[model samples]
Target chain A: MPTIVVDVMPKAELLDPQGKAVTGALNRLSSSRESGSGISEVRIGKRFELTVEGPVTEELRERVREIAADILSNSVIEDVVNIDFGDDAS
Target chain B: MTFRIGVVTFPGSLDERDAQRAIRLAGAEAVELWHGEHDLKGVDAIVLPGGFSYGDYLRAGAIAAVSPIMSEVIDAAGTGMPVLGICNGFQMLVEAHLLPGGLIRNAHQQFIRRDQGLRVENADTAWTNEFATGDEIIIPLKNGDGGYIADAETLKRVEGEGRVAFRYTGLNPNGSLNDIAGLTNERGNVVGLMPHPEHAVEAGFGPDTEVAMRSGVDGLRFFTSALRALAAV
Candidate 1:
């Protein structure tokens, strides 16, 4: 079986309010440290793990990529970072 | 014959009853439709009322955008059936590709609820024919993900074509680009907005008016406009 992973993130040009809020909270938490945690940023996104029962053939890879780009992420606002198959199951 | 308008109720829909009531008050027969239903019960128009459908699991309106009945709505909208999406319903419209642009979280990262002022930008749509262009109205607005966004080209196209149906007047409640509050499709049959027009159909239970609080009935025009549209057809 081949396991596939898809990561989705807001387009860089668009604002990520949730990610910014999380980063702001982190900055506040680390402000009092003698040496700040040095955690300068956080960019939040979604990840999906899909498993296939058979080998990850070229056709399967194409189909998975299509789904990841067209359905898993909205092209207008979000983008798919990558689609990778585990075990190099090509 | 009474015009029949369908109010779709998804699993988390919170305003189907109010939409149906508004339709009835507009002298139309209100029909309740379901997300799972394939048929629209021969409705003359459709209203996708607001709510956090599917609990905003993946994204606001993302799951419900692909619901079974949406295919039918899509087909009808293509044939010029009037369809109005409010709030979360507007999110679904964008998610389903029934409308342009996308809605993201508010800039302040907080859920906002308040009476909002809107300027009617294009009154030729099936849902806005009752209001003259440039009319200002008060309606209730409440949402978390309500900021409207689009690429520069798309924004220019919508604006140049006069597809913007309404715009925020007094204040940009959610930081929507260009102060847009609502929009219509090219044919003007499908409209979507962040405000809750269904909540303002009746006096004493809607947004505040200049004379008294909760006396606004400006939202009634949307339903009445639908009635006029159906009558003309």
Candidate 2:
């Protein structure tokens, strides 16, 4: 079995409040230490792991791409950042 | 003849009953539509009520948009069937591609609940026919991800075509672009808004107005507008 991973993130132009909050927290922690204040921003996203029982064919890859674009990520506010097939895929 | 409107209840939907009650109060028969079913029960209009459908996983209304019933809903909407999406329902409508743009987390990063004032931008839609263009009304709005966004081109088109159904007035509560609070498709058959009009349909249970507390029944006209749209058909 091969596992396909899909990563989805909010669009770059949009404001990510969750990411901003994390960034703020990181900055606060880094400011207390010398030479650790380089963190600037963070954008949170989602990762979906899909397991297929059989060989990973091009057809399956295409189908996964469609799913990623249409279902896994909403084009209006998010993007399909990456699709990775694990090392098991021959 | 009695008009039949269907209210869809996706898993985690919280406002279907109130929507049904609003429909009944508007002198229309309210039918319950399920997310996992393919039938719409021959409804004249459909409403996707507010709630955290699928617990807002993978984006609000994402999973529920492709549910079994939405296939029927998509087809029916194509044939000009009237559909109203309120609050989280608005998210589903955008996810389903029945309406344009998308709602994102509030700019202030907080859940907002308030009696929101809105100006009717387009009064020709099925759910807004009872209002005149520029009519101001107050509806209770509550949501975490209610900020509306779109590409610059889409915004231009939506504005040029006058598809914006409602605009926030007095104050923009969620930082929605251009103060857009609601929208309608080109044919005016579909409408989606982030406010909970169903919550404001009843006089004693709605927003407080100058005359009395919880006496604003402005939301009732949304259902009545549907009735009027159906009656004229």
Per candidate, the number of residue pairs that clash is: 0, 0
The residue-by-residue lDDT of candidate 1 on B28-76, one tens digit each, is 9999999997999999999999998999877788888889999999999
The alpha-carbon deviation from the true structure for residue B189 of candidate 1, after best TM-score superposition, in angstroms, is 0.4
lDDT of 1 by residue, A1-90 (tens): 668999999988888998888889988888899787677667789999998998888888999989887678888889898777775543
Pairs with steric clashes in candidate 2 = none
Query: What is the lDDT, from 0 to 100, of the residue B2 in candidate 1?
Result: 92
Q: List DockQ for all candidates.
A: 0.80, 0.82
lDDT accuracy of residue B127 in candidate 1: 98
Q: Provide the lDDT at B165 for model 2.
A: 97
Query: In candidate 1, how many Å is residue B165 off?
Result: 0.9
Total residue pair clashes for candidate 1? 0
Candidate 2 stretches with Cα past 4 Å from truth are A33-36, A87-90
Q: Write the per-residue lDDT of candidate 2 for residues B107-202, one digit (tens) a residue.
A: 888999998899999999999999999999999999999999999999999999999999999878988999999999999999999998998888
Q: What docking tier does model 2 reach? A: high
- The sequence of per-residue lDDT tens digits that candidate 2 reaches over residues A1-90 is 788999999999988888988898898888879877687889999999999999888898899999999999999889999899775442
Model 2: fraction of native contacts: 0.85
